[model samples]
Target: MQKGAEAVHAANPDVLVILSGLNFDKDLSFLRQRPINLTFSGKLVFEIHRYSFTDGKSWETGNPNQVCGQVVNDIMSRGGFLLDQGYPLFVSEFGADQRGTNVNDNRYFNCFLGLAAELDFDWALWTLVGSYYLREGVVGLNEVYGVMDWNWCDIRNSSFLKRISTVQSPFQGPGYNESRSHKLIFHPMTGLCVRRISFFQPLELGPCSESDAWDYTPTKTLTLTGTYFCLQADKSGQPAKLGIMCTNSNSKWQAISDSKMHLSSKLQDGTNLCLDVDSKNVVFTNTCKCLSKDKTCDPASQWFKIIDSTRKQNTTKSFFQSKQIAQFLGNTFSYIL
Candidate 1:
């Protein structure tokens, strides 16, 4: 395996040389002893496979959460340790049989997701298409596991996509730290993995005073009247208002009416504050920003900043304060018109 990996590295210096079939057993100390043989400038990713049925009935016994937790811990102990040592851990394959009802699949999925969340690992589902020619006499595949149906014309199981979408989405906020590791959002209904901002924080309407109550809505869009302060506060109680909305345009925030505010700009890179002046409504766009190898941004500003000695030291604390401000403002003035 080492020789093969080294050969690949020698051939393609810029490609990731992945070693697969580490299988389910997971004792990989051999990797440590291997000499650096790569003739390339790429990374090495170690891959593993996991499934609910791997241990037979383990997932079926005991408290679901407890059992699943143990399973995840066991997997991590045996294989996940490699990841902690600066090596990448990839769950190259995982999924439940589609023969069962949505309930069973959902339960299994929850457990899978919980571990994925706890570990923050990268992975790929079993497959994109249905109808695998397994060794067991070409077993008719389950619609649940296949992202698409046998004919490739219909989506066999959309909920699967939805469940994974939350796991794959990049939008990170208060109620969604577990799901933030997701880098993409898949719209099951459309079968498209378009980039999106998942609103992790539940909208808080109580923070707004009685006068501001009109601006709060459970829906994503908000309506408001006149200029209003859009504040964001974090866990520490510090608050920061990105800006006060006076006029709506295609650039800043979208104006639906003289008094309503909706998101016109993308929130994937920054917090989008959408408000309407006439109706006193508001929408918080908690989009997650993807950074390039050379780009870095302040979590508070979601904008890139030049790195300086003094700036780097202060960024962590300041970023925390800014997050607190954004959260507090979201909680406090969500309804304040």
Candidate 2:
């Protein structure tokens, strides 16, 4: 390990140095006494691997919430020492089987997310694709640990990405303040991210208009009208535009306008609510009483079911040699004006 570290420093002293913990025993106390070259550069980072299965079988059968707590404790017990010494810790690889048979993976991830949000560590998921080559043949083949397919083409599970993205990238802002009132819509099974902003203001003539009611019966379509306003932005923030989106499908809520109008409605829950613009504020009235009461304005109220039909095909057989692995990362943004 010291020889490797020395060679890395000899080649590029300025480059960030990372040391990996070998085997299952990761205690690093012995490194403190070694005469290894200590240029004392600030770029040295330590890497570690973690998995839900490492905690024990109890995590697999226990209640999700209880299992999550145990997982947190186990992780802390293993790496708490390094964290106390101010070393930068990276969870280089972590994932669960994609077959949906491991309940512990889900609980472990939820706990990992909560802890990650509260800590300063940086991490990358185990993989973005299924399949891997091994000496004894593919180990965890066609597993769901990957975010995309082995071909590196379409996303394997979009809802999974959506859930992680919410905790990873909570808001979008160039001129807008993220601290202000904002909303996010996430699909846990497919990693799609959407953000919405609502501002307090007086009403005016525009696309969003007050309506008696609306309906979303099969071929039925509805329109909403209201005044749109552009929020004044600070020099550091992105200029804000108002818009609206409508649909029962949480994954594909269509936007009516992009930063163009404020008063607008879309068919949701088989009905529509039209915004009546007034000098004081916009008012919402149901076009159809049945749909109105059911069309919740809260984004969190939306739910999604995992759809296996959306999984992409895996074309790469690299899981055999362990030399080749598929990787992909992406970001998407949608705004409802």
Candidate 3:
């Protein structure tokens, strides 16, 4: 790999060289023992790939929370650790079925988006072409993972596109300094965040760009930044509101379930309620759903990912430059792992 990288540099020194892990670009832990002897510096980037099928039917058979945690831990140990070592890690390939009907793919994607938001790594969608003319003696073979339809005219899933828009911009990294770390209550199902319109208004799900900055305190209270109000639970079907009473049982939220995606809190009536959203995007606290091992139930409305962000509004640098670390080197980062 080092020799190949040197040759590539010898041919074109201006381009960045990316290396992939073994075992089909999924394992890079071997780097801990046998570091690459690359002579080139600043142009070295590592890549990794992940997909729903990579772990078989784990999402279908195991608990979603446990499955998500296990997959994230495995990913970190495999290649995500490079980010901590000051190396640029590229998620070269990662996608799920765009149709959104497959149970396994649907559940896996929810977890995938949450991790992607947290990592904020550079990534490439799995595919673009929806259909091919010929492959293995087939005509017009369809690519279910393609972002576009089979005709390549319209997007296959518009909501899917919106869901990924949050991570398309880097939340925090080098070349950024104005951002103060805060939490954004991201709903993976809708690619939106919990936002408060006003002190007197109820909370609602809106664009992440307009999400209210929040601070999850050590006391389990989710308080709005620069405000004394905490997210308080009301009746079972009532919209969640901002309240000054921070110590009350209704304001203290606990991340329940194995995935820890369910932000559950007690109501004034002692009812255990989870943060949920209605069809109109109104945020509320409802009796928790699918807290057990029920595969048929869809708990998407209740799955909230508290993503950490340090992106301050009104940064002057160009938006493109802040998207990926590789952009700093004046090269478009794209590589297959």
TM-score ranking, high to low: 3, 1, 2
lDDT per model, in order?
0.43, 0.41, 0.83
Most TM-score-accurate candidate = 3
For every model shown, what is its TM-score relative to the native structure?
0.48, 0.46, 0.85
List, in order, the clash count of every candidate structure: 39, 45, 1
Stretches off by above 4 angstroms in model 2 are: 25-37, 132-135, 138-140, 150-152, 167-337
In candidate 3, where is summed lDDT lowest over 10 consecutive residues? 328-337
Instruction: For residues 165-184, write the lDDT of model 3, one tens digit per residue.
Output: 87888777876444688888
Query: Could you say which candidate leads in lDDT?
Result: 3
Task: List runs of model 3 lying over 4 Å from the truth.
Answer: 175-178, 267-271, 313-337
Candidates 1 and 2, the one with greater TM-score: 1
Residue 44 Cα positional deviation in candidate 3, in Å, after optimal superposition: 2.5
What are the C-alpha RMSDs, in order, of all predicted structures?
16.6, 18.8, 11.5
TM-score of 3: 0.85
Selected candidate, larger TM-score, 2 vs 3: 3
Give the candidates in order of lDDT, highest first: 3, 1, 2
Local error of candidate 3 at residue 46 (angstroms): 1.7
